[model samples]
Target: MADEPDPQLSVPVGMFEDIEDLKATNAALIAEVKALAAQVTALADGGGADPGEALGGDEAAAGGEPADEGEAEAEQYPPFILLLDSPAYDDELRALIEWVEGVLVPGYLAEPSADARWCHLWFEHPVAVARLHAAWLAWQELTDPASCGYTGPSVWHRDHLDPALRELRASTGPFAGCTKGEHQVGHRLPGLVPSAWTHGDD
Candidate 1:
């Protein structure tokens, strides 16, 4: 009995199996890390293939082709504020405000004048909100190197920024009654003609 292995010191078969499993898992993880490192090195050396394609495989590298129509539409357009729910809208509005205050006002907005007016409470005006949100979306897309490349900023300035400013700050635009120092009190949207459908007219 003394020559035989002591039962007290014997390892469980299940324990050995668990250790083997862990070792295999660790090996797989190490291999994945090595692969990721190689990809990073390739990108650093300016390899021809896109990094997204390398990680996602050939399906993702299909020359920017989306897997489905819905995905394609989503990729093309940013989420519009009007389409969002209350919480999402609030979050988006906050981001838009940050961009407006931090980048737009300081960098592009000129001193408020009678000809080029601005309202302190511009958010209160629905038209102003819609216009600003559109411009902000364009700015985000055009400024990103991954989205539009080097010429994007120039195109954004010429097409999006200038037009939005001209419309919003025009004498007859949404900020018409506002001034440099004060918001327009008792501000009201322009009255619209009653809908023909509401009156049962063709």
Candidate 2:
């Protein structure tokens, strides 16, 4: 009976309950810390957009295929469209198409063809070039005609039209069969203006 008298003081039920609660809280905190670490990793890797980021795990955002950087770059600038540069199609045209598509298209599709071989190829498919030209004109119309300045076309015509570009146009490569008459009438592109196309955020 004397020893039993000190039971409440020796081990208080409230203290035991507090100890159990502390253990649970510590376990929960550990789990939360782990989850935060995973999210940090996810964010470091281009946050799931371009996998080329240093952290990796760069999943394409919005569930689409990862974009090619070169294609993206070419799209930013207007590249010279090589219509008749298929050498099996025509040697000069092939070289022109190769130069434009291989080198220029790799950058921006800006500037019209500058070389005679390129011009010849373009002339061979005048209709197509005309259509492209019309599109270019329309784009020019979108902006101030004065502001439609292109260094590539202007400079290439003025300076780089020598053997380098010429060789490219005439080099018996793949796209030599292009003709001047193909694009005589020109095809109407679907969305020439922003209002002509539908954009969906969904």
Candidate 3:
């Protein structure tokens, strides 16, 4: 060595070790970032769970499914449940079922037929949801204070409830051969040929 350089003056050996440690930390952080990005993309692309069906932050944070009230609250409420609507087997469709059982079934839908217990099993029918939604919408509007009490019920029955219930409770449709004794049976769907169960003397 023509001129001996001070060892301490040279880039310290400890610095090299620090750089290696930094590199590993950076690599790990980069990997974590990439993973987080991928998760974000998946959530965006798939249109994450239905808002009505999704659980609250607490359940999600704890990695648990909603139970009891959370599950009940999310079910068929907020209209977001429409996207995830399954039949009765799912049980997550509580709102629609509750409305049907509490309001439509009790107040409007005709009594269940002797052969077919449509009232008990209405949630099983896939088409029942759309019909329920229509009726529920009418109920919300007609029951609102702005609606004229005398005309609201009549309009709902004529414009929304009757037509929807006709298709829903039609004999040839899902709940076949079922009818409310007080109401007409064999009501035909739009495209289907009419049946001969007209209300007698009403």
Candidate 4:
């Protein structure tokens, strides 16, 4: 005979649903708490909007349809602020890399500036430069009192600078990807000796 369905083995669906709901509710509370902390910090530093406006408590809720539009349109955190404000996490970290590669790379660093120091040949080390520039930009933005982000000098170094530079400076990073095996590289510096053999010629 087929085994009867084990009634004791099946948990009530409501129990799982309740657990998930509690998890989500807790996460939201954590986010709100961090946001509140950032608001307090920004105000203490003398730059952000009123704490009442930042918190959006029940008493501070908007009055009309236009207010709904404003709420929908407003950025909860600006992109640069999102980089260093880690207690309130962002899922769009990959998007920061994409924007850096797509925009900041081509626009700013692809070609060395005319006034750039000879040691600052960014095109030869695009990945490292890109990461550094991105980290530097995050530092400038987050440390500003008006950024309304929970970032200090140490926090910027720890959060924004450390991880990116670590990845970018690794051997498998962009320069290596573009240089090893059969890859062709165009910009050797003036004093560098020529390679004995072309990468793919043999």
User: Each model's C-alpha lDDT?
Assistant: 0.77, 0.43, 0.59, 0.53
Q: Which prediction has more favorable lDDT, 1 or 2?
A: 1
User: Compared with the true structure, what per-residue lDDT tens digits does model 4 show for residues 123-165?
Assistant: 3453454465568567656678776355576677689866764
User: Could you estimate the TM-score for every candidate?
Assistant: 0.58, 0.20, 0.40, 0.30
Off by over 4 Å in 1: 1-77, 185-202
Which candidate achieves the best TM-score against the true structure?
Answer: 1
How many backbone clashes can be found in candidate 4?
Answer: 0
- lDDT by residue for model 2 (89-158), tens: 2554444455455644456443333232233344344333433333443433344536446554554443
> Residue 27 CA error for candidate 4 (Å)?
28
lDDT of model 3, residue 32: 51
Scored by lDDT, the top model is 1
- Candidate 4: residue 89 lDDT (0-100): 24
Reference-based TM-score, model 4: 0.30
lDDT of 3: 0.59
Preferred candidate (TM-score higher): 3 or 4: 3
- lDDT per residue for candidate 3 within 1-202, as digits (tens), equals 9599877789978998999988976776666556555556667898665433343433433344545656686664444233433463255467667778787777765555543235456555545655776677667778776755768877887888877877765655556644443322333234532333222354
Task: Supply the global lDDT for candidate 1.
Answer: 0.77
lDDT sort, best first: 1, 3, 4, 2
Q: Single out the weakest 10-residue window by summed lDDT for candidate 3.
A: 181-190
Off by over 4 Å in 4: 1-61, 64-119, 123-130, 148-151, 177-202
